[model samples]
Target: MIRGRITGSVVSTRKLINLVGSKFMEVEYLRGGVSESLIAVDLVGAGIGEEVLVVTGSSSLRALEKDAPADAVIVGIID
Candidate 1:
């Protein structure tokens, strides 16, 4: 899992069937106190300004499906 802060929300009027109802958020990836500013999909409900944990790769695919074509997914919210 990776740690990051939610910066904004992503909007797509048209998306894949699997992603039809899913939400995506822009996350500023943080490491060593620096931000990478990456965007990720949100399977769980997370809001801007909130710290979040993200999952990727096959593990993420297992959680949501690899065929979904998502690079990242918000797995949890951190206080």
Candidate 2:
């Protein structure tokens, strides 16, 4: 899992059939010294500016119920 902050969002009206009803967020990973950003599918209803826990690879696929062709997904939001 990667700890990150949701910095923004991605709105796509036209997506793959498998990704039709998913929400996308822009996250900046908060570990290490490097700041890396990625677009993540939001499985936990995380919003911009929230700290979130993200899962990647095959876990991302399961988190979103396989509706995700997503490589990264927000699995939890941290307070």
TM-score of each: 0.80, 0.87
lDDT of 2 by residue, 1-79 (tens): 8999999988999778888888889999855798999889888878889999999887677666644477998888887
Q: TM-score: which candidate is best?
A: 2
TM for candidate 2 is 0.87
Global lDDT of model 1: 0.82
Candidate 1, residues 5-46, lDDT tens digits: the string is: 899988998878878766789888867877687678887789
Off by over 4 Å in 2: none
Give residue 13's error in model 1 in angstroms.
1.5
